[model samples]
Target chain A: MAEVKLTNVVKRYGSVEVVHGIDLEIAHNEFVVLVGPSGCGKSTTLRMIAGLEEISDGEIKIGETVVNNLPPRKRNISMVFQNYALYPHMTVSENLGFSLKIAGKSGAEISAAVANAAEILGLGDLLERTPAELSGGQRQRVAMGRAIVRHPDVFLFDEPLSNLDAKLRTQMRVEIKKLHQKIKTTIVYVTHDQVEAMTLADRIVIMKDGHIVQVGTPLDVFERPVDTFVAAFIGSPPMNLINGHIEADHVVFSDGNRLPVPPDFTGKLADGRQVVFGFRADVLMPKGHTLAESGVVTDLDLKIDFAEPLGSESILLSTLGGKEIQARMHNPRPVNEGEVLTCELHLEKCHIFDASSTKNLRE
Target chain B: MSKFSRAIRDHAVPLALIAPSILVILVVVLLPLMFSFYTSFTNYRLIRPDTLWDWIGLRNYQRLLADWDFWVAFGRTILFLTVALNLELLFGLGLALLVNKITWGQRTLRTIMMFPMMFSPILVGFQFKYVFNDTIGLVNNALQSLGLTEFAIPFLVDRWLAFFSISFAEIWMSTSIFAILILAGLFAMPKDPIEAARVDGCSNWQVFRHITLPFLMPFIFIAMTIRSLDVARAYDVVDVMTGGGPAQRTELLWTLIARTAYDDARMGRANAMAYASILLSIFFTWYFFRKLMDARKHLGAF
Candidate 1:
């Protein structure tokens, strides 16, 4: 296992720059996921690390050696593509043994390695079957088997499970995590799915338009997002961001709605300052149902447009200060549409961002 | 009408629509085929209408068994087909590979490469025949001007040179068929497996040998099948250039068959020869088709 470091990595397509100079360091054996929206350059960064895309600027180091100029094979990296990229002409046994054969290993050694990989992947019966005969999940397993057989220093995955169905994606995600745990190899995975990032990454690197926005542990980024983008991107259903301004000791919305300045940010803020109030649906629940017990419980009558009961909890769609917002309810009750329900906003669990520039005020 | 009769009438409408085509095939194809088979058993001659009633049975078949000239022509045609096909495949593959690597001007180059294939075989034959003429040919004139030779080379008169000249013209006209089909295969190939191969530590040559070549095999066999059938009717080129002349040096089956049928008026013998050559064509097509199936199975295409 080896650490991967990218110093001022930039990728340019002709005169148009796609990935700006971005620096990152992935620790050895760490599962670091580069998560972002489409065209956010996360895949480009991963490709640069894999040596599939050329590094236009700066240095990339695997362990101690600079690998900026190295070809993919010479970089000693194995990548699983989004499509699983299995060779259609070869059987499972041949696919697994390709790398070893290319490395000039003996026939016995290649067969043994292939057998071991097939065993780990539970592909004993599929050794002779070509990729076309295998199901999508089996092809994915063969792709992974091919990667692991090479024993590369770093494993790169470019949205490897995005093609699978939801259930299969989840199952494969768990298997990939388990594989990482078993092998203890440094892995850099790129995906646009935040759920996959949150569940699989040791640390999530949030990117936007070729720039790294935030790099933190899953819980850290979830509990404390760097800005409105991260706050909305991380959690399912997203965090509610209501625009407002600071006035004396209270935060005021455009529609004359008011709430006390979250006690944590009172000292650092100034009067007449514009800010956006952000909070997750789970944190702001029906009155007396909030999980945060020690926070200032600001209760308000919210008009419920509709409610979605998800068995354990219900997501109530409502509006606040002339903007649409969602509130979570734990104890399901028959609340009719257009009913004004009292909901509490946990001040301790809220995020306040500067309205003019969307940076978190609490950061 | 009853329900059964109505259903049958509906099916008849569709069948009636295609009846004209079936009639045309019977008159144009099946009738001639049956008549030719019957004529092959008789001692028929184009100039003598009375010979149509002369049923000679196995006499013409017996003569064919001892016909050394016919066998030599058959063997020579096979040799020509083999040499031309293999050379075309090699050149076509090389051209396709080189063109596939081009990024800019690719469309223009592709259009230009199809120019040779557009020319008729007769035109190609005439073009090469003049270029290889004994005294007024481009090749001999250029060679003499360059001090590479003293006397004019009788290209069409010499046995081996005539064969080479005809084969060269045929290859020039048809090699692009292989190039175009193989290029299409190259286009349809997915980029993922190639990248995966590279990531699996395969060098450029190894990736091509193990991955690209196998992927292109099915396309190659398809091209071979088509060109084999097209080349079996290699009458136009050979007839135009040498007319199977110079002591029957480059006498293909069709050339000899045409001479016997039209010039010598031996219609029965020509029909027998035509039937025999049809078997060779069928054999090559069946062989290539089998190879194509094997290649597809190897690729797991089902």
Candidate 2:
């Protein structure tokens, strides 16, 4: 295992610069996920680290040596592509042992490695099957097996689970997490799915528009997103942002609705400063019910536009201070649309962003 | 009113739809094939119409069996097919690999590469005939100007040189058929396998040999199957360039058949030779098709 470090890495296609100078450091045996929307340069950054793409400017070190000029093979890294990228003509065992074969290892050593990977991936029965004969989930496992057999310094996965169905994707995601635990190698995985990053990454790197927006542990980023983009991007049902301004110890909405500032940020804001009030759905549950967070709470009445009951929890779509918002209800009875419900907001759990720059105000 | 007539009447629309095609086939294909097969057993000559009724059973086949010249031509034709097809494949593969690398002006280069394939084989034959002319040809002039030799090289006269010259023209005209098809194969090739091979620690050549070449085999066999049937069409070029002369050095099957049928007016012998050459075509087509299927199976496409 080796530490993968990128200092000011940049990627440009002709006159168009797609990946701006970005710095990242993935420690030895750490699982770092690069998550972003399409065209956000997460995949490009991963490819550059893999040496499949050239860095326009920067230094990438896979241990003690800079690998900017190294070819992908010489870089001693393995990649699992979104399509699984298995050799269609070869059987699963051959695909798993291809790197070892290329490295000129003895047949016995290659087979041993193949057998180990197959056993780990539950691919013993699939050794003789070609890629075309395998299902999508099986092919994904073979791809992972192929990567592991090489024992490269780092593993790069580019949306490897995106092609599978939801159940299979979830299963493979858990399998990948288990694989990482077993192998204990540095991994730089790129995906647009925040849930994958949240569940699997030791450190999650969130990017947008070619820039690294934030890099933190999943809980760190979830608890304290550095900016509005990270806040909205890293959660499902998304964080709600209400446009408002700080005025006299209270946030004033454009439609004249006002709420006192949470006690945590009592003195952090100046009067008349425009800001975005952000809160997560789970925090604003029905009164008297809170998840893990216990803090100073505020109560507000919201007219429900719709309610989605998910058995243990329900997502209530409503208007807060004249802006669309989603609140979570814990073990609550189903409520009718347009019903007025009082929900509690864990004041300390909410986020506030500067309106002009969109950075977290309390960061 | 009968059962058969009633059945036919019941399928009248479908029968009517197919009748024209069947009639056309009988008139244009089946009749000529039957007439040719019949002539192969008779002493039919184009000049002597009365020989049409003469039944000389197996006489032409018996004479051809012992004819040393016929055997030599047959052997030469096989040699020509093998050498020309292999050379074309090599050059075509090289050209495709080179063209696939060019990012700029690739469209223009591909269009230019197809220029030879666009020219008629007869036109290409005439073109090369002048280019290889013993004295005034471009090749001889260039050699003379460079002081390589005092006498012009007999490119179309010496037995081996004439064989080389004719095969050159054939390869030049049809190599792009392989290139175009192989390029399409290259275009359709997924980038993931090549990338996977590279990540698997393969060098450039290894990646090409193990991944790219295997991926291209099915396309190569497809091109071979098509060109095998059409390689006979090179008769026009060979006829114009060497005319099966200089001791029959470049005598392909079709050239020999054309000479026997038209030049010697021995239609019966030519038809017999034509029937024998048809077997060669069928064999090549069958061989290439089997190879195509094998390649597809190896790629797990089947």
Best of the candidates, lDDT: 1
Q: What is the TM-score of each candidate against the true structure?
A: 0.96, 0.97
Candidate 2 chain A, poorest ten consecutive residues by summed lDDT:
A286-295
The lDDT, on a scale of 0 to 1, for candidate 1 is 0.90
lDDT of 1 by residue, B209-254 (tens): 9889989999999999998888887899899999999789889989
Weakest lDDT window of 10 consecutive positions for candidate 2 chain B: B293-302
Fnat of all models, as shown = 0.77, 0.68
TM-score of predicted chain B, candidate 1:
0.95
**Model 1 over residues A249-350: C-alpha lDDT tens digits?**
788888888887787887777888988999899877887555656667788788899999988788999987777899998877767999988888887888
Query: Candidate 1: DockQ?
Result: 0.64
Q: For each predicted model, how many residue pairs clash, with residues at least 3 apart or on different chains?
A: 0, 0
Cα displacement (angstroms), candidate 1, residue A198, comes to 0.5
